[model samples]
Target: MAYKELIGSFDEVRNYIREFFIYGIKKRSDFSDKSGRTYDNRRRQIESWLDGYMSFQQSASGKAQIISVDSREVVHNPLYKAFKTKNFSDYDILLHFCILDMLAGGKELAFRNIAGELQEYGFSGEENVINERTIRLKLQEYEKLGILKVRTEGKKKQYYSLSADAVDLVSWQDAIEFFSETEPMGVVGSFLLDRKELAGCQSNFWYKHHYMLHAIDSEIVETILEGIAEKKYLELVTSGKKHSEEKIKLYPIKLYVSTQNGREYVLGHVSGASGLDFIRVDRIKKVKTGIRCGEYQKFENEYQASKSYLWGVSSGNAKDITHIEMTVRAAEGEEFIVRRLEREKRNGHVYKITDQQYKYVVDTYDAMELMPWIRTFMGRIEKLESSNPQLKKKFDQDMEQLYSMYFGEAQNDIS
Candidate 1:
């Protein structure tokens, strides 16, 4: 047989095995009726090939052993139940698994090698193609989380096995455990599952804390997003414990994600607010269509211009931009801070912070909404500066007074 023909035959056999594992089949004999030499020859070939494959997998340092379902007892865990109930798709999970399988043995396979193996596994189709960059990013994420270590050898790359503690599976139980701890709810959990690169078993602590879905009704949120895309105006009532009594008018434009809280907020032009205002969808009550938004075209320029300073979607009407500066002392091993600063610089922002210490200035219209972020950096922040000297003095005095109040209370209690 030609080499190409042999490769094709082996691929077909591998596919059959995958199908067999996914669907319980007793044996290849269950489907074949040709007895004697023909049956025995094919069976022996398959068995030998499978044994060799399993051997290769076992010897690979970072390889996850493919579990034989028939030999193992499958548990009906909550994670599994949720995955089944949701009918979640695992295409991305499978793709990553295949890549990990190929990159086993601490080998730094080329992007072409990874992509070719995926193609051989029937992952690539005319309409569905996976790019090299996507694979590189997924591998990078694994490396960052300590699941895999990546090394470059003058263009050719290799990945080393980093202890197996971070490895995870893609079944329903594993999905549940991953999401329950990472995403607190189904909306974000479903979104996470949809991304093939992100569906891996490894977990990132910062990602879990920053990718949370806010307390918004998924269906209603989708409707709001659709409405914004279609350029329709909405009359909605705020319905949370705090905003229940408030009625508001809004022209929905953009959806904003809060990095600190992992919550999603809607940013649009509120009728009464001076500029763009952000409202949490979870807090929105009776939302109804009001106008067709024919005259709202004029606001597009203002909206487009405001996006530069609109961090987390709450754009205020402060023409005087505040130059609030703070220095952050990143914890040891926290190189993500440097990456974040680089990203900010790429986006045309002035990020003068380094790996050890960083400084940033945000032009926030409503300073109150930025307080939570300030609190997060309280432990790490050593220096605070403002463009306006008077404002700086006032901020300093406020901090001093606040600290003094807490300190005085502590002394009184001690006495």
Candidate 2:
């Protein structure tokens, strides 16, 4: 017998995967976004799906529940089943069968044709609102997905069933393995490998920071991307540090994802702004299409030029550029250190001073954004000079604080 677990919304499943599995080891209150009743329902649903894989541990403060899957014990990722068991409504199931049955006779039908057929076939029950609009929307979606092909002749448009694009296991084997391990939403790719007789690939990634919600928000990402593709303006309702419940119009530029932390951001600018701006997708409360981005090329060019000055996402006005230079003392066997600096330095230059020394330099819009990374090479950092004196002070202050925190005022006495 198949276990049918019900979910209230996609958000419920999202909360489960985010709270218990991806970033597990979380307390009950960690899910403050949802009501207590809603949270409990999701927890129960997750337990039903994962079954034995879910477990709880008692901490000093509270109990923390998590999904415990040992690769050596479990044959496959347990979460794969979670994706398969999406809660579909009775209407959804009926619509699926109806769409196929109507299209089965090698017939080409318009939205109206399909909807009329469904009406005659009697899909609507006592209280159902399965109207022509609903049926038409479904058929149009099917066409887009390549499940149905559309033909346009003279002034009329018609659609018929077309074979969907199928994947070949032989060619996608390695690509699947690497994707499953490294990328977010790789579970879908991994799920494809399971469809083949080969089962899952041997490769597995032990993700320390799995921002799995990015996959769920692929809809938002895709919508924004489509808007960009059409060169359209975006209306964003964003709540973050600078803005609170603020609604604004933005020109679509590009999306940025942090490799260090798997957070996604959209980079764009509001009207009459001298500098580029960024908004976190997670922080975005709502998004809508505004107008056609007729001047997108201008913003696109600005975005390209802005890239050179960005050490991170933080960028200043068009003219603001801060130059920073650092001398590093690399030990005898750590030549890889120099190589590391060069490879990771975006829009930066690394020059070899001698056998044991190197100079790393970069010009960025905001030097403040680059300081955290600069602090990483604390011991080896020599003559940390910046075009911005304030940034230099902050860096020196941070270094001093670190020294005092660890070594204490004894180091101050030595200085």
Candidate 3:
């Protein structure tokens, strides 16, 4: 099958990776949800980004095609490359250069002047004719991106590049290099390093588990960030098992990264909704600019308050707080167990009822999120209870099932 060459959005790239590489061995015909052309387009796009790690095999007599990946041979995940971002049209690249070139070292100009300059100096690739409307739209976009500064005289709006007089790079070089390699928003540091012509020079920072996908990760982040910066509502399009697409208008407050899992989340208030919501960045298929949504400081402050007691992102209801208690035996050489409980308990309280006994208590919005942590104590947990009795009952059932699986067999042996 001939591969389609068009590059789609990050969501397309992400889903294709999940389908063909992670939970792969899927038949080409199985992708009925997408057009044959679209499926091929997505497959080709994935090949462009992850060519080294991807391969396809055929069924008996070559009746079907199945895609797969073998990570054992790959040294690094190529998914993080900037190219995996939404494919840019030729016009986008052309305008970026033409507009910046015309505005750079020249007086502020409108779209007509820029379009005329492009018409005279000529555009590269595809269409050569100038479209003033497209130019105006791109200029407005650049103005929003801070790539161009706009000025208004009476009614006319003029734009210019935000000055190329190299930013003061003397003191920021070391910091930029280090940050670019390790931190979120570090690409700015990377660009600074590139500008300084020191990109490949060795640095002290190195991460063994590089989240290369975060390159695409931050692409989504930059949008919510733009909303946060402007204090506006953002249009978020997400896909789910039930809904083909779920559209959300969010007053984006802050981004939350999971410590247990390296997932990025946008914590915000649903437009017109009363409580904070956590939206995973990976699930986001699209983001668009929206009208001003007023101040986020109130929600930001409330979210911060929730953070004090939040164990994880599974806050069921904003007002629903459940108190959980787990009594564990902490005697003799196992004092480290109590110390560990103290260290990992976040805002939970740890009290010693007796020298050999202790109870770990926490009031949380999602008592269920703490179950895996409770299970870590195993045989030491003498009692487990939660103000949410349903949680307690579920835990009892799980533990009883576990006991029967192991101890029930032992009882049979004793009989």
Candidate 4:
């Protein structure tokens, strides 16, 4: 009911940030599901996290505010700050520290002993006494998180903090600092970097094409990854402009990160569907892991076999493969163009047809996805062909329009 920087539900915050701050611009009244006060509070929360990147404008709909960030410029994701602000109760905090303290110095205790020790601290929240049930619950939670390890002694269970050799922060500081700023689960590295031993550690790296938005999508990505690791089917809840909650069931195969835009996707085989398709991480609202997939290996093998034909995420038109060939002329000094083609032509081949002429060929599930990359060689392209006549026609029409726009109808021939 009241405004606070700390959030209770990340899903609710993620939805507001994606819909209003990251994806589109909208007036405050556009949110029909929530009251104006709620909208204002959510907006303020996001603005606080994205302090320098936010901007406001007077639009036809009304005055609107948006988070405008150039992904290439930022060294780290500001959105990670929102995730760090989760609210915790006084009892939860006290119990966490108490447990760690009790289990410190290689001390191990049975459940009853741990509960007795916790009671000795006189811990209470909201006037309720901290009972054995609460202490047991906290221990269970920590055991699942690997913070505590449990062992059975006959019929009784003993719990102790999981200990490991201390990492040499001096030796690994740079790597951890770099990972914290750039990796998908960099937030984990960030937590490590925050330890008091590394208080003065700083990152010496920066990315030319840093994508800051993925931090917001990391939670869902982590869930999908868990399903993938366990070889389980995932029941996903996806939302879009037209569809608020479209449920999908899939055998998740792999997580794909786009090199072009840094967006993340999950390549999975939909239940009862024929082939693997990619689901963009941002579209996912919730991921509920389902039953263990008995045929996970079968689908993974199928994806590996079919992935060669994938130019992009499109699994292309239900098994209809398209072939494309193009000839391009690059003058003697433009060897860089040839190298560029060789570097970017995924699943495609390039060979010199002549001193100045080169031929590029590939088979793909969807040739349409390659159009943008093909257009980059407009002036150098001498000939082009596609097995899908519609695709060729679309490319020809687009080239013709470009020629007409720049050179007039008299010089409408792009070839």
Candidate 5:
């Protein structure tokens, strides 16, 4: 069965237990023999699956350590009994221990680097392997639990380190005894304890940012990301009015988030195009990597300046600079409007107006694209005016219709 199917069955079995207990209480009788046997079997199956899962995790973690041998053992010892008796499932404990071990390795690793190391360690098996995606998720959970500290290294890189005072929790002897008792049962339990003692040394080393695009299948997107990291140029077919059958080469500088959707797009320059261009990955048909991009430094200042005028990811053709404005009211419980507006301004946009009643603004692009944000504050705001006369008229008409439908003296009276 698929992993998801197994997970569904496990949840169903757990639900059955809750239902069975409820029915037993209602009937004022003990569970039937058959029902009791079924519950026991299902519980056993879940435990077995959990054991297998943990063993795989431990094995993968060990392999990762072996590959990154630069890690030194931590000096502070953690209490093994404290961790073992905490009611954490065997899988949870194994995952926790693996993360601790990684953090103890003396170097801060990025999420992708940790995932890649896990993959390399041969923890993934044919039927019940732990995938890198799952490992990344588990790492996040560990961070939330305060076992690790996650901090951003750059825009895309997140580094993980051991939490303060993590080493003082348990002693080396306690860890050894706990491992000895649990090791014979499963791979996860055995491997963790086999090391004799927990590593306690702390060091200051950080991993490089390696962006791994997960959902995109476009080769062009992959080529572009890889090219940017390697400082290389790429040749691709143009999609806009300057469409050409011939492939054009350009140096990739940075990635921008698409305004329409949260999808990523490449912001680069065309070799002979008049100005900087934005190309959608899905629109490009072909891509070829070229030599290192030595000219990227020259465009850094220009890119920084252009960011303020950008509407979403598209800088909107280098020549067309359309100024946009909109009015939005802050909803009753939505005091976050001011903070959000401040954040936008901090990112380099103009904050035209901020007052008690509503917010008005002049931004670099069309306000229609920001309509969703405006709608979120519907009851709070009223349409005022737009820099472009046509856009202002449309917004005024839309707001009037919305007001007629939902606005009333009675609606304001309740609050």
Candidate 6:
């Protein structure tokens, strides 16, 4: 109803920012799930944060708003700002400062004393009274978050602030600067760099092809990691193609991050399923920790056995392994092409067919997943064969289509 920069639901804001800004979904009607006013409100909220990165373009569907950013040029990730803008209630805000001020400077206080001080400070004021139970609950929450430490003394628990040890930023600044731009959960490094102690902090590094948008999915990634570490099943609420939510019971075995695109996926087996599934981390909306899975080790072993056949995330089926052999010509001076295939080919074998030719072969879970990389070596490919006819057929069809586009109907005559 009213415009606000802070969003109550990170999931709702994340979806809007991803669809409109990152994925470039134009036309408000394409959202289909929410009303136009709802879209506008979310858009305005995102714009308020990313106003500098935002741009406008005229498309056939309508005027489109886009967020265009070159990750190489930016010193800090702009997407991390979205995580900072979570809405906090007035009472929550007041209690936060009040509790922190009460426990300032490594001071420890019993629950009763802390409650008395809040009351003395007019926290029990008629306008906004905070009860003892709420204070205790908040303290317990903080203790779990490592912001507060609890010590028991004679039937009473004392709570005090736990501050981080000071690190020499001058020595570690470059590592923090690099990690904040490069690693998953990099926002933690970004937060460290924001400390007031580093008032004169300057970034000494830049990324050439940074994938920063995935920073928004850090919370989901953390939860999945928790599930993985605890060897527990996770209940995942995943948004599907039609915007419908599907709840999956997954026993997460591993996290796969694409080196090429930085897209993250959780490799797990769904409940009662025979084969493992790779669900994109970004598609997940909510995760609930489930009971400890006794069969976790079995699943882990299964994944380990099958991973050798994985080219990417697609594990086609347990029994259906696709074999592919690609022969490519590498002229005398173009040994780099052979070297490139050797370096880039994961789990695949490459051998010299002749002085000027090489054959690369592999048995993978899915040959279809290898199409994009195979396309890059199109002109050099002397022959391409696959156990799956569809893979070869599709490659031929695509080759013919490209030939027609560039060389006209001569492709048909040549065939």
Which candidate achieves the best TM-score against the true structure?
Answer: 4
After superposition, the stretches of candidate 6 with alpha carbons farther than 4 Å from their true spots are: 29-36, 101-104, 119-124, 154-156, 159-164, 326-342, 350-360, 375-385, 389-415
What tens-digit string does per-residue lDDT give for candidate 1 at 20-46?
Answer: 322233244344445545434544444
lDDT of 4 by residue, 247-361 (tens): 8998898888887777888999998887788999989998889999999889989988888898888885545889899999999999998998999998979999999999999
Model 2 steric clash pairs: none
User: Could you tell me how far off, in angstroms, the CA of residue 394 lies in candidate 6 after the best superposition?
Assistant: 5.8
**How does each model score on TM-score?**
0.41, 0.73, 0.68, 0.89, 0.41, 0.84
User: Model 1 Cα displacement at 320 (Å)?
Assistant: 4.6
lDDT of 2 by residue, 236-301 (tens): 776545434778788878788887766888888787776678878766656777779778888899
Candidate 3 lDDT over 1-415, as tens digits, reads 6664545555566666655555453556767775888777776666665555555565663333333433343333345443435557778888888777777774677556676788766663466765678878888898876777777766765645554455676556667655654455655665566554665555545455454445455667878898888888999888777538889899988777765545788888998777788898878878977998656678778777787677888654546899888899988888999999999887888999999999988889888888888878888889888888887777777777786897773232211
In model 2, which runs have C-alpha deviations exceeding 4 angstroms?
A: 1-87, 94-136, 153-159, 164-166, 180-213, 240-244, 272-274, 318-320, 331-333, 394-415
TM-score of 6: 0.84
TM-score of 5: 0.41
RMSD of each: 21.3, 5.5, 5.8, 2.9, 19.5, 3.5
- Clash count, one per candidate: 6, 0, 1, 0, 14, 0
TM-score of 4: 0.89
TM-score of 1: 0.41
Top lDDT: which candidate number?
Answer: 6
Question: How close to the true structure is residue 325 of candidate 6, measured as C-alpha lDDT?
Answer: 94
Candidate 1 regions with alpha-carbon error over 4 angstroms: 1-216, 240-247, 271-274, 318-320, 327-337, 343-348, 351-362, 367-383, 387-415
- Candidate 5 lDDT, 1-415, residue by residue in tens: 2221133222244333223321122111233546655545544443443332211112322311001111124121111121232234445556666667766867788887776666544455784377666677787887886767888967978998887764432444454434333222122332344343433322122323211111222334557778888878898765444433457788787766543343456788777665567766545556779888777776666677676666565465444455554455555576687666666442334243545544445555444555555455556555445465655555556666656677642232121
Question: Superposing every Cα of model 6 onto the true structure, what RMSD results?
Answer: 3.5
Residue 305 of model 3: what lDDT?
77
